[model samples]
Target chain A: MTTSPQNSADSRLPLVIEKNLDRILDTWISELQVDGGRLLNLIRESELREQASRFLDLLRKAIKVAGVNPEKTAAYDELRDLLDELSRSRSEQGFTPTETATFVFSLKRPLFRELKEAHGDNDTTALLDDIWQATMLLDRLGLNTTEVFINTREAIIQRQQQDLLELSTPVVSLWNGILALPVIGTLDSERTQTVMESLLQKIVATGSDIAIIDITGVPAVDTLVAQHLLKTVTAARLMGAECIISGIRPQIAQTIVHLGVELGNVTTKGTLADAFALALKKKRQKVQDI
Target chain B: MYRIPILRVEEFLLVSIQTDLDDALAVKLQDDLTTAIATHHARGVIIDISGLEIVDSFIGRMLADISTMARIQDCHAIVVGMQPAVAITLVELGLSLSGVQTALHIDQGMRFLRRFLAGRDEEASDERE
Candidate 1:
């Protein structure tokens, strides 16, 4: 393990890459194919070759300007950008982090072969130093791809959470002056805020006098959930719309009693049908057999 | 001293707050509304806050006070047309205004007041019989 001076290793590294660009790419592609798992069938050979060649071209340019550690310098911005794009696209195509990183790491083997071929038996220390620098550079780039891949997955999760928040709290109009909000999940403070806001907004938009908050889809009844339900009911009532909490399954009713949640004044019923019947009666309308 | 207008519609005194009510204006409206309730022999008072974009705790307290005072004078106070945002703010501020009767619009407010007054009138007649 000879520690060659930084300047000599940095200067010689880019020359080795530039001299054997095509040979390095050919070997890198074959290396990727050998190790490729499900990802081999997912992406085509031509597109993969184009991406690998572009990455190598930018890498050589970045290394020439910013040495082996091109991460901090602006010269490697294009190289980093290409890696970011590759990571994001691969993530969207359902590629695992290991598969995405293999693309960058596979280049190391090909470059090592070319480096060995370029520096024959003479100058063995310089050859080892070059290999070390190339190893460091490829490792950094592979780690960068993994970082971007993980980030892309996190962003997708965050966006789906926002989408779920909007999709879940839908306030439907059941009658002329009635609205029904069917809650379907756990009532956290944030989700409760969303549920309350949407229900209140719909009440104002529809001028609904009576709102039935059917908790049939709600899996459990906790004190916090009860508080959120009460808050939604109170806000609706303050806006001049009375709320009736229906769909109290027997188990939920027992849970409510055990939790000692006071659903005070806000009417509750066994089923949506009974609540709808009461709402109709309040509106002076009746549903009978035709 | 800017005074909020109080329009008398039939047996109900209608107060539509069209502007943001500062402390003094809100107090003045509360004072004038109680006086108008007495002068017009109003059976009910409907305070419409649909035009109000913002309401602080002071204004919320004044609304509750007016409702309680109207009830004392045998006049029902129904706050009508409260904006959803204002209602949420009031609820968040821990002011439910539980004593004040509420309706979605002026029309609903009138209907509610009529039913309430009619029910009271029947009870009074029943007491006499």
Candidate 2:
């Protein structure tokens, strides 16, 4: 190991990448294929190679412009964008965070091999210094890739959750003048708004005289949920459609009573059928059970 | 000056709000509706707001005021055809329009008024007996 100027290793890092760009890319792709796992099947071979090539080119350019460390600077903005797109696609394509991070970390081996082969006999100390800088840079980039991957996954989950919330709260017309809204799942403020909007819309469209809100599918009844229900009932009343809350399970009944919640003139029923029957009765319509 | 036209349908007064309501227009609507109720001898009033996409607090308050004024004149005020978005906005704005009675559409509103008036007629006959 021979001592040399510190800046020589940092400066030569980008030069080594620039000189052996094609070879580094080729080696990087092969290395990625070996440990790339299920991500290989998700993305096509040509697309993968193109992505790897672009990343290397961007990496080389960013290093030239931003020096050895390229984190958090305008010089690496394009590189960060590329990584963001790559991680987003990976997330959509079902790649795990570890797998996404591995895509970046896998390039380190080929880069280190190229650096060693290029300057192996020149000076061991400078060669190791170059490898060290490469390791730090790749580690930081790899960590960021994982973060972006996780963020994409979380965003996908949140959107799916919203869709599910919408799907579960549907208002259906049970009769000519009556609407039935069966609420399934926990009642959050956002979901309550959806319920109110849909129920009120159906009432207006159908000119429904009575609305039955069935809470059988709801998991739990808390103060917030009760408040949301009250708000819905009140809104429907204001619209001139009498709202009857039904599907109160034994547990929910106990919960409501235990909480000392005052429903104040709002009618409650033990089952949706009971509420529907009441609605029919209010309309002066009756069904004879055979 | 814009005035929301109030039309008379038989014994009921019909006002279809097809445009947005400003403070002046809404105030005019309140006065015009009550005057029309007396002019037309309308026993029922149906205000159709299906065309309105937004209902701020002021509009909601105007609706409540109309219901109150109609009630004082011995007329049933049935606010009908309120858009779902409007209802949500009204509730979110903490304005329940408690004095106003709502129906899904004109047909329901008419039927509601018919039932109410019929019930009133029965009570009046019973009082005379």
Query: Which has the greatest TM-score?
Result: 1
Give model 2 RMSD, 1 decimal. Answer: 4.1
**Candidate 1 per-residue lDDT over residues A151-259, each given as its tens digit:** 9999999999999999988999998998999888888999999998899889889989999999998898899899888888888888899999899899999999998
Candidate 2's residue-wise lDDT over B21-94, tens digit each? 88889988888888888888889999999888777788888888889989999999998877767777787789
Tens digits of per-residue lDDT, candidate 2, A1-290, equal: 45543464444788889999999999888888899988778888899999999998998888887776765788899998999999988888887888999999999999998888878695787788888888988998999898898889889899998899779988899998899999998899999888888888788777787999999999999999998999999888876789999999999899999999888889999999999989999988998979
Q: In model 2, which runs have C-alpha deviations exceeding 4 angstroms?
A: A1-15, A25-54, A57-82, A92-95, A116-140, A288-290
Interface RMSD of 1: 0.8
DockQ, per model, reads: 0.73, 0.56
CAPRI band of model 1? medium
Model 2 chain A worst lDDT window (10 residues): A1-10
lDDT of 1 by residue, B6-116 (tens): 999998899999999999898888789889989999989999999998989999999999999999988999999888889888988899898988999999999999999
Clashing pairs in 2: A239-B102, A240-B102
In order of the candidates, what TM-score does chain B achieve?
0.97, 0.96
